[model samples]
Target chain A: QTASPAVAKPSRLGLCASCHGETGMAVMPGAPNLAGQRLDYLRQALKDYRDGRRDAPVMRAAIGPIGAAELDALARWYSAQAPAAASAP
Target chain B: QTASPAVAKPSRLGLCASCHGETGMAVMPGAPNLAGQRLDYLRQALKDYRDGRRDAPVMRAAIGPIGAAELDALARWYSAQAPAAASAP
Candidate 1:
């Protein structure tokens, strides 16, 4: 399938997937899942990171360059993905 | 002081602040704000909407009876609040 621009291009979601995993399932202790997140919620988060509302040194830098369109795509992609299986390891 | 139990009980970020307000912003138009997100990405989006793996049927019944120390006190009170400034309305 032809991935959307957000999916095809490097996006904030991609940055998130770097640690949160491609499906929003956090692979590490600190990362978190983005899969199935509310699009509105996700959008706001990206905006937060970009606008310096949220505080995450890495996240701010990560989401800094992202734009609205990309953020929307990211949100849609993650929101559509299935939530990762729960496993407390 | 004392507002800890996920901001004094009633979590899921207080039902997403009854519509993503209370700091997270997102007054309307799909609601998204959540000021200063990122507490491990809000604890994997409340464990992917309580293990359904993300799909928002009203956020899986509103995080389906949240736990995990109230989602880490609502991801450390919306990652310490702040964000919420940009307006697209």
Candidate 2:
């Protein structure tokens, strides 16, 4: 129904901003750049991390107790950005 | 030095093919299609899963004791594929 400013500008979002950089460019090695990533992929990834299907402790810690709505917001926010491909690996 | 036949044909390569589909199209709802994904991202992902940085039991069991060379091979194989979009949640 309504929008939260935090959800609107995901680049500046807390925690996620650290390793993933402001716009999902990824600030460190081993972190996948989320910009321009398919919304479905980002959703699945975050979901997997939350559900223990994927092992990312930092991610779990960073995104604690996230629900479907929040996951969607975060995924949508990151997927729309222009991902930095070269910074990967 | 020389490529293993198993490594060459990644689409049919073991458990990865089960969920990711032959061409990385994704067989299930939570699976991320790997086609056209950046090499760096793929590398970090596989590495994270193997090293326990990412908590994927199925992945860990599927890829046991994988070395850098194998990781590179898998990453290269998956990255070279033409990823399928439109499967987002």
Question: TM-score winner among the candidates?
Answer: 2
Inter-residue clash pairs, candidate 2: A40-B88, A54-B55, A55-B54, A55-B55, A55-B56, A56-B54, A56-B55, B35-B83, B36-B83
Q: Estimate each model's TM-score.
A: 0.48, 0.58
- Pick the lDDT winner: 2
Clashes of 2: 9
Model 1, position A69: C-alpha lDDT score? 81
Tens-place lDDT per residue, model 2, A37-70, is 6677788888878887765667768877787887
Q: Which segments of model 2 are wrong by more than 4 Å?
A: A1-30, A33-41, A44-70, A79-89, B1-7
Chain A TM-score vs. truth, each candidate: 0.77, 0.79
What are the per-residue Cα lDDT tens digits for candidate 2 across B1-89? 12223337653265787877665556765566665466777988888788887665677788888888878877877666653324444
Off by over 4 Å in 1: A1-13, A87-89, B1-89
